[model samples]
Target: MMPETFLSWWQFNNARGKQPDMSNKCPPVLHVPAAGEQAQRLAALSQTFISAFTQQPQFFTRAPGRVNLIGEHVDYCGYAVFPMAVEQDILVAVAINTSGRLNICNVDANFPPYSCDINNYEINKERPVWHNYILSGVRGIQDEGGMQQPFIGINMAVTGNVPPSSGLSSSSALVCASALGMAHSHGLSLSQETLAEICARCERHVGTQGGGMDQAIAFLATKDTAKLIEFNPLQATSVTLPPGATFVVANCLAPMNKAANSYFNCRVMECRLATQVMAKKAGLPWRTFQKLGDLQRALDKTLLQMITLVEDSFEVRPYSKRQVCELLNTTPDELNQVSLSENTRHIQEFKLHDRALHVFSEAHRVWEFKKVCVEGGAYALHTLGRLMQESHKSTQLLYECSHPKLDTLVELSKGLALGARLTGAGWGGCMVALVEEDKVEQYKEHLWKSYYSKEAAAEGRPRNTLLFSSPPGPGACVFVK
Candidate 1:
């Protein structure tokens, strides 16, 4: 096999410049289903190959995009969320050498080089913070004995076609790629469990604390299908996209300010408080309430009571709708004479309009959406669109994770991209879009004028915005793609 570096051999064969007859944009020699591309006519132009490229056959890995079908903000809140790996992702071509060196070059010109070595892989080093995601993965693997003793130096190059920070889990895609490369080169077979755990730790390298959704999706998903992944004890099940219509996604171009100290943490704290309040009322620890009916009843009662007291009950907060015991530490029995009508109003307001409702409903919506997607029923696209809108509404009105800029972008996208909503962690993160095929160009044009143009004028040429369509690709793969 001549060391089986897939690309090296493919390029060697392709060097004769033999033209591929078919119109498929993919190369004649490569049949990687994970690539999620299949236009037999090679898509990469001759310009792409002018510069020499190397693929170390010793290691190969792929990671996919994580799309939160529903339950966007509930992941970090200990709430069940539904997300799936889309067809798009990052593929890493890695090779090990005795050169005692680590170097990385991205296929796209957008990001810079990622180079580091065993000795210098310190905790939270600053110079190449951008590559920290991958570095962290490598370090985690090494920490867990996934690395070999001889310091298996690597010359790795990455090709990232995935849009950055559009909330598609690009960072996770890269982390998994690095982990696979490291594990393969070091002769380690990391079970999915270990891989997910390693990925969680590696993600912190990006300087953003994230749940394991991105990494898990990249590692576990299958082609042409979405996976409903659960974090606790780690479970994965497929959720199929409807056949006829493609769910389109657009980049709102607005970025999240997750780096801020209090923003992400405060939401986390709030969710914790909600769970604790529910647990206390139920006379159980915060962990139980596995059934939907049980969870719904508790949340509904808790919130409806708070909503009832909103108007006349000065003790109840219009926003949080907490009882005196919740806020002022008063006992529930002490308020036995409290106006039931007023208290009920407050609880209703909280249940319907408060963030608690969003968490519970969004959590529940995941199951609903999964069932609809799996059964292949005639679920209208409008209905799907409405669910997406509701998901965003919950994120915004209830959860308060959405940003003003994102809301504006969503408003702007309404006339163009069919459905537009926040994609990632909300609070100033990326938004998703569902554009019809022919309307894609029109949508992008409108988006450019509306977002990038103004941004460029204000800030001297903003980054490039990508628009792509990919079918569900293989979860993660080696030379088989």
Candidate 2:
């Protein structure tokens, strides 16, 4: 039976003045395209179900997918980053629930029902041992606020197009969506700082330790521009782009599951170790050296100084993204005594390795990256792109993070007269390519004919080289229908 058609609030969220109960300020907005939306309409139209389920329409909120233009792997250390929102975002429409629980539904047929009892959720150092990023946001809201701030149940339906683990900050989008949805539902006010903290901590519930880069921009980004996220001091700015210049990001459906190798955590530990070695050499506390850029300065001084202080301490193993794929030959669940954190110590590398050199310099590149974008300098962007390719060489050569197939895509991207870099933690994931808008068509064709479709013909793989533009999508905001 064709489902009844109630007003599609989410579909119309972007319509001017369509958002309900919003004040004069440019409130954060969301748009959710979901199958659960149909379910809601069906339930509303069906007399018996509407009466039985209880009907209370409420506000919808959303957060967008994020691509870190620069400053990868820096957020966890509290470094500033540059990120923008895209047109794609997760939309959440929430209503108050007397039952006092977070009820969630999605349009995606594959998405299962997700629910949590608000009364029972916890946000302590070790709690909510689940993948519910929103639960952590809820915990943050409660913990960060006073008891005088009461809580309310949320009846919600969420849906978005961003793929999970695609290095697009999809999870952060969900966290931001839920945060603002709940905030609006209960008439609460929040700032970017508060929202970012909530989202970052919530991510930890799922066993990932990350800084707040994704959450911050998803929560705070404005429209059609870039934002620079600063780390040494936590500040953000919306930057205007040079005329006729756009950032083109291509997503390869070749989503390598980063979780398998704890790729994110391993890198974090490596950074910690690198800092410790640098600290001893500097005769200062590890915490004193603020940015990764600082460590590079110390390392450049002399090899004797580094060798004495960072001998075994500078550990770089083959635990990179490519190595993870090779290691996948073993079944993760079947293995006993498998500790990523423990074996992490195994993959440590020498501090003086070229990859470390790339990493050490990459920290500085992020800042230079911002300068090019902000200065509207063509030479600067291209110059930065050269550094990016250099960075890729480091990841592929020094860090050993590239797969033959992955490297092919980078080569393919470069062949199309574009500048490219291996994005995310590397391995078999997609790379970020900056192509002129005019050249996008040629780039797409080259990628497919060269690699994606070739994989299809040989192994019957689905389309792999997916391409899109990166928009400065906003964080969690509410929309009413």
Candidate 3:
């Protein structure tokens, strides 16, 4: 079914004028060609599955990667995020197997085939090999179904073009796709929201300690409309883009895998520590607060007031671990148990002021961006653009996640794009720019010549996929042939 079908189904099942209710339902089943542009790709993947397993696939699952339009790093803070699903996604073809072994292969030859007993497999956090993402999903479903329950084995062939480690949620997409396949193969019926939440928790098995933005957008996004995804009961509301405004994603050609290092989690811990300190200051149970959003709510303060509180509370200097322990009135061991992840326990210092500043401010920008979209006018594009630029500045300066290449891309877009910001978990990945529809081609041309054309990484890379305009695409779904 097309996205119109999703909308129509929503209309059919509910009273008029209410928002589309997509909860408590399985992903809509569609025919192969209903997948549109990727029909041929799905067909080829299905053929590969047949040859590998000697049986036709019972079904296929697709989960799209998302580009965060404005909100960044706030999802884990329990704030809302605005993101749209891209056409690029992870596609899995699955068939039941009788051998009681889970066989996994990739359409891309770089990944070697692997098999394991479905009931006995471990996700590797040490190396985070490509298949481990899929394994994260398998483990998620197995746990969800209860380990004591028997599960039939499955053969899965995977393929994706979301640019791994490019901050586009490719890893999360794989996890969602695998979990969806596993759930369906086992006669389990799960909603998109349930699967998304499960995949989000399970992905931590790979050691990223990420928030749920990636997985939530992957499952809940709708076609042609960006979604404002709120956590703690994950809900999605569609936001329409203003007319004549185009969003383009360009690769910085630098990739950072969140699981391969501690940079990502370090920021997560910084936010956590900031929240606890503030909670304690506010006379709330510090241990109960793990997110800045939750802390803000407990205080019943607006985002602006939270920003002010951060300024009043934390010194600008980086807080050494010892200093942090002293402020919290706890020993390093107790502090570690309360605030730090395993990967971040070794960290020496935390920039509580800057990280808190960024999260609170960026969380505010998400709402502003949505407001500009909701109240579209002659100045809506420019207003939204300005908010995006501000977001980039905070991410670069305060969060310290932006890479030199990403900064350079934003610098290059100063005039050509209305606004541009590093889109993903930033150490290196892609930057999203907002451009007038008429200026999009010129913007791409300028970026290619000034940026990609001069880099060795771009020497043989395809320009179309590397730099492209993206509208919101549909969420995860299953295809029945």
Candidate 4:
């Protein structure tokens, strides 16, 4: 089918709009095949759904994974992040069921089938099951007070190309697809912005205190452009990348599950404590501030100014529980109750200096990265590459989130790409490299030979699955027959 003829039978006018447009102002609809490769992908997923459920699905919902190009770990700090939707995505085929229970299946046999009553459901936080991400989205909608009728049941078969625990946001994509499927199954209408915010809050049920960058980009992304995703209203502005540059996402073959461990939450707690301490030092209602970005705004200081303030206020040595309690003028119990997360309450030493310095400096790099992308010049690529390298360094030294494998990959990728940095929440995820379009082949070959080949020779495994290149793709959408 041609692009214009795709999803022509959906009749979107009755729901929201007639078609998807360049401005991305309309609700996400699959009127056109997302680029060339997704056409075959949609067809295969449709067939899989029919075979799995023994019924033709009414429609399909898609949510793409995102790669943070420059910004790292600052989204929860309330700073803007630069990210783009990857072509790899989660696609779900949905069919209405009268059984009053939601049935979910995955094409990958590793994840088993899951089913629960739509009206009565509970998310498991003690041990986060994979399907809880879907449940969280459904619960989010149920918590929203404006629904006219209760949500109906659905039979969903899902397929995804994005690798799990690789820092490409496979979980968030699943949550976004589930939210879209739940809303559509219930005959409910939600704007893209509303859905993004709801899904963002909903993922918190899985026990990660993340900002809205993943869901916002998953819903608001446009083709061929990275988005400058901002919070405190949740807006997305498209950013055209410099020409002849390609983003290559390389996996170190190491997986890090953020929900299962406290490494991710530890950084979050440190940032929160750092914010409150900085606010208390500045005498700006420290109790009201929770994020580093909020403190920056309250102090009316530039990003550089924030860095200076961090140096002046915080010591290089780690702060003990007693020291923090004294600084905040509270007891250890009170500090634990108010400042720390459930997983981080036992942490006695907090790296206030390093975490605060990373947040301020990294936030500054995001703005500079955007400026280079917006105002293209002869040295734009070089300048942008330097910023990315600096970001990786700060994430390594200051945030202390980089794994040994990630550091080795970054070191091996030098001279072949403009810059390489660990993306996502760090601690052994994927690293995104900015490579010239023409040099991507050489870059891949070099990485394969330098890193993957050595590992394969040592362990007797395949080398080809470790790396690939992707472009900015569309966000969440619905495909109707």
Ranking by TM-score: 3, 4, 2, 1
Please, what are the lDDT tens digits per residue for candidate 3 over residues 1-481?
5534643453354334332233446677677775556887888898788878777777799999989999899999999999999989999998766677899988888888899998888777888799999989998998874435677678999989899888899999999999988876665667888888999999999998888999998988899999999988899999999999899999999989989999999999999999999888888888888999989888999999999999999999899999888877889999888889988899999999999999999999999999999999999999998999999999999999999999999999999899999998999999999999999999999999999989998998899768998889999988878
Candidate 4 TM-score over all chains jointly: 0.92
Give the alpha-carbon lDDT of every model: 0.58, 0.57, 0.89, 0.85
Query: Which parts of model 2 have CA positions greater than 4 angstroms off?
Result: 1-56, 122-131, 147-150, 257-261, 286-356, 398-404, 457-465
TM-score of 3: 0.94
RMSD of each: 10.1, 8.8, 6.4, 4.7
- How big is the positional error of residue 363 in model 1, measured in Å on the Cα after superposition? 0.8
lDDT (Cα) of model 1: 0.58
Q: On a 0 to 100 scale, what is the lDDT of residue 138 in model 3?
A: 93
Number of backbone clashes in candidate 2: 27
In the range 1-481, model 2's lDDT, one tens digit per residue, is: 1111222332243244323344423355434334575345433323322232365445566678876666556566444566777766676556656566776666554765566777576544333322366666666556653335457566666666566656777776777777666555554555666666666666665556667787777766877777887644446788865554456665555565544455656666555545544555456555455334456455565324433444444445433433332333333332212323443545533323333444545556666767776776557556656766776676777555566666776787775544676666566655677666677677767776776665643355333325566656555565544
Please report the candidate that would top lDDT against the real structure: 3
Could you give candidate 1's per-residue lDDT for residues 127-158 as a string of tens digits? 43446767777777777734446455676666
Question: Which of the two, 3 or 4, has more lDDT?
Answer: 3
Screening candidate 4 with a backbone cut-off below 3 angstroms (N, C-alpha, C), the clashing residue pairs are: none
| Candidate number with the higher TM-score (3 or 4) | 3
TM-score of 1: 0.69
